[model samples]
Target: MKSSAITCNNGSFFNVFDEGMSLVCDEDLQALAIAVIQTEMKAVAKLADRIDRQFVQACHLLLDCKGRVVVTGMGKSGHIAGKIAATLASTGTPAFFVHPGEASHGDLGMITRQDVVLALSNSGETEEILTILPIIKRLGVPLIAMTGNAESALAKLASVHIDVAVEQEACPLGLAPTSSTTAALVMGDALAVSLLQSKGFTRDDFALSHPGGSLGKRLLLQVSDIMHRDAEVPMVDDSVLVSKALLEMTGKKMGMTAVVDEGRRVMGIFTDGDLRRMLEKNLDVHATRVATVMTRPCTVIASDILAAEAMQIMEAKKINALLVVDENRHLLGALNMHDLLRAGIV
Candidate 1:
């Protein structure tokens, strides 16, 4: 009759009942964990077999829709329906979710003749959904239903039905929505991605939808947008003394400077790291030309390449800062890791 005692060890918490009856007793916990994972995995595996012509028809319907996709559900299905709508909207398909109960009130006005309806219900007999079924049909809107019960009223009435039946629930009592919900969510992702690819949705398109986030910066920011421009670009004639190059590097504070010929084309680069090696070889900074000590044929990026790509090249080449060059190798600007960090592309 005593309350369970909870304790933390090695970053995990465990519960102890009277007489050391552990809530997370190793054997029981392992069995429960494996059962949950296996149950959900099996549910997803079942979907593989269900992906026949119905799946293709559903995708085609969504792809060809001239207007937005309207999604609706009740309770737990409502939560999953919202996520599906969001995925579709963010991936080039316009979609929005409306609660079925609200639809009975006045939200039904949101649906237009050009819109498609998607409904979710595990039992496929949700009263709120069924109440509005006649109206949706009379309006001639194409209805797609995701449900476990093929015989349920909602499924039978839908233009296309997707089976999300799971053999069992991950919940020990078999009443909680565990495996069924996971299956529905996965199916939503499958539909969204397929539609995205069919429409040729590119990364740039996704970035436009998510312009306020870091992902947008990674996809939309080019080297030209963040690189040091005009006089801020570190450059020196190739014939300049290595000592003079060091002065330019220090003044610019980018730890490097581009070595350019008379035509202002990049010939090489000199960095603090190069200075260290030059000192080791007893090269006279005063007497040595920047060309003799510079790292020639250095890494360069086009001004138009994504800043994210520039970060990749810098990481791979084991260097910071790159000369921004034209297709013909004329120096346009310069960039370094700090620029990427500041631009939120790091």
Candidate 2:
């Protein structure tokens, strides 16, 4: 038993020493990683070379489509197809993913002649997908094929073929759909982005599609939609004592109040910031007038302005709240940065 233990220890020692002394240790693995990435990139780069009449025709068909872009695939291609559909849908191209299996079972009814079908298959032949090729052709809906095998049956049947062929798979066995799927995904992203640029998709347009997301809030939310309005606004006349304004401010819990004139136009703004400066000057809060300590030319914004733009202005001016005013400069509402934060517009 002792001899066996010594042999085992020697074996481990030799193994460690051999690995430490090896000059190419882990270098081959790094090279392989780089090679895989290069292969995927080269595949995508070939798209420019392949951009002939077929690509232009495909773009034209999609541009003229009045209905949704139906994207379908199988296995790993299906996952990529779903993402492509989502990207297209968000980028002005109305699209949805339909499982090829489900399409054969009656979901094909969701497709229309006005719509264009984007099919993904690395081999250009997925049995479930091919099974519906005839039906799609019969429906007279245009087929845009995204595949590696341009000579395959599906490609032959396609109205336009986009070759997303990769040199090889990243998998050592070259059996898993590694590089092929990556090529397909990159091609899909390229298509979506191209369509997006062609459509002149503005931020406002993107916001409309993403109303529940942060991007929508940034573009669609207006200051008037969130600010405290009318009776909810805390304000006082210049003649009012600082104590009176403080009471209004405290009651309203805005940490400040606007000082207005006889015309109901904002004359100045009083806030905790002003209070800090007042305390430093040893001024008596009760004896002071609202105008004495208020900040003049208080940053004001129109109610029609986007909340995100308002946030930018407030941040750039180093202020927290903005007095919302009308065209005639009458105080309409009040908004603090927190208001935007709560509304998810910040």
Who wins the TM-score comparison? 1
Tell me the tens digit of each residue's lDDT in model 1 across 1-346.
Answer: 5756564554455677687574774556788899899989988998999887888899989998999999988998999999999999999999999999999999999999899999999999999999999999999999999999999998899999999998899998899899998999999999999999999999999999998768999999899899998899999999999999989998999999999999999999999999999999999999999899899889988999999999999999999999999988999999999999999987
**Residue 340, model 2, lDDT:** 85
lDDT of 2 by residue, 51-130 (tens): 77887788888898999999999999999999999999999999999999999999999999889999999999899999
Model 2 residue runs over 4 Å out of place are 1-35
Candidates' C-alpha lDDT: 0.92, 0.88
lDDT (Cα) of model 1: 0.92
Model 1 misplaced stretches (Cα beyond 4 Å): 1-26
